[model samples]
Target: MDLRRIKDWTLLPGASIEVRQQGRGVWSGLVDAVTADGEILWVIDPSGQRRLFEKAEFYEAWAIEERDGFHYEVTKNDDNLQKVS
Candidate 1:
């Protein structure tokens, strides 16, 4: 029931996540794919780059869950992202 632990959440492609380090925006976008073991996540940043992120120390991933009154959608497989109200 908190952001500290999201292991229970099923991370899927197209999910919105904004990761940051040292109070700076690293990157945020719709998830493109996830490792089979769920240890890594691949996201397409705004610059059209495929970046890999691992849930570990010094990393914070923000997910706009249903309770947040917002959601994200990937219009197409190309990772066209849109935040829905």
Candidate 2:
């Protein structure tokens, strides 16, 4: 799915998201809050509380892809990015 498609679906609390920060690596966390400007605030597990971050900082959409009951790979790309909320 693309960024526009994901953003179209409301991302609320309790939703799991794979965040790939610049030079910080990837992590999965619950979405705490989302800004009107598309900035996402979430908490990293085993790290205490949540942190604020912008959506534009993400290099790609990270998600688990499974095929034939086996783990395929973690995908990333810029094609999923969009400007609107």
Candidate 3:
């Protein structure tokens, strides 16, 4: 799997993603919701734990996609990752 830096994209519900901050792994889970204004993100983990993160400049979001015979161009998100510091 390759990770691409996104500059323009939106987080949609039910998508799987790995969030990184300052070159470190943060959280990886299913997206629950993103505020209409695009300033906040909510994700649900395997244990049904829901967490909220605020948009920040240091956050990076990479959408994990599987493809080969089923390749997909990951939609990029310009908005930074959320608050968790």
Candidate 4:
């Protein structure tokens, strides 16, 4: 929601976030780790893969879908989407 919150959240392992790609839209995944350079390493466990994202590549915090596995969905306050608050 905010920079401090994002930074605090992105610091936690296993925390999920939504990453918006240039043309692919949004993707959800768990935070696997954070690099010293402030890059975030995320894992899509269902796909059993991890990817790195820099701060400039980020969009916003995501709402998690918890079922058989975890999935991420982008949040939009304007659209009244669900959020952790």
Candidate 5:
């Protein structure tokens, strides 16, 4: 999987996203913005708290939809995974 392409996806404001932090909990929220260089992301949780995350902080991130919930399917291999959305 080309993680760079995933990171570069144009996540518009109000887009739903789920991020799994390394060795920590997961967070799901509406995307506030993705930095123009695709290095940082700002998300607003349901409680209205805004959080910032750098690309390396999370192990996985998925762009979600309100209707189907999650946009992609993940296939895992030895120490690797691919996302098919």
Candidate 6:
């Protein structure tokens, strides 16, 4: 996810997200808040559990309106997040 490409969405307090970690099941949640420098995101899952994740940990995320059977892949390389769809 290029910071420029997804920054707006991630900053929205209520934006919904779906995250997948390597070898782990997917996690879904709502964005609670974002750090001032935009390096970390605070999310609250459906169970009301809060978690903090570095921007790079997000392998996939998209807004609810854009989730109509669409998929995204986020990867980090050379300190940049790249999003492939």
Task: Give me the candidate number with maximum lDDT.
Answer: 5
lDDT of 5: 0.60
Q: Identify the runs in model 1 with alpha carbons over 4 angstroms from their true place.
A: 1-5, 22-24, 65-85
lDDT (Cα, tens digit) per residue for candidate 4, span 1-85: 4211243333446665565555243556677776655555555645767665665665443434332233334466546664232
Q: After superposition, how far is residue 6 of candidate 5 from its true place, in Å?
A: 4.2
lDDT of 1 at 71: 41
**Candidate order by TM-score, highest to lowest?**
3, 5, 1, 6, 4, 2
Assess candidate 4 and give its lDDT.
Answer: 0.50
Clashing pairs in 4: none
Tens-digit lDDT track of model 5 for 1-85: 1321134434435667776666344777888887787668888999999988787755445556532323455667457785644
TM-score of each: 0.54, 0.43, 0.62, 0.48, 0.60, 0.52
Q: Model 5 — which ten-residue stretch has the worst lDDT?
A: 1-10
Q: What is the lDDT of every predicted structure here?
A: 0.57, 0.44, 0.58, 0.50, 0.60, 0.59
Q: What is candidate 2's lDDT per residue for 37-64, written digit by digit as tens?
A: 4455554554656766566666322322
Candidate 2 C-alpha error for residue 26, in Å:
1.6
**Can you write out model 6's per-residue Cα lDDT over 39-81, one digit (the tens) per residue?**
6777789999998767577544445434433345687756867
Per-residue CA lDDT of model 1 for 1-85, tens digit only, reads 2122134223546766666665456887777887777667787877888888776655555663444433444333236443332
Residue 30 CA error for candidate 5 (Å)? 0.2
Maximum-TM-score candidate: 3
> How much RMSD separates candidate 3 from the native structure?
8.3
- Clashing residue pairs for model 2: none
Clashing pairs in 1: none
Off by over 4 Å in 5: 1-6, 23-25, 66-85
| Residues 1-85 of candidate 3: C-alpha lDDT, one tens digit per residue | 4554332234345666666787776887787987777566777877888877666756665566432222245443446432221
Candidate number with the higher TM-score (1 or 2): 1
Off by over 4 Å in 4: 1-10, 21-25, 63-76, 79-85
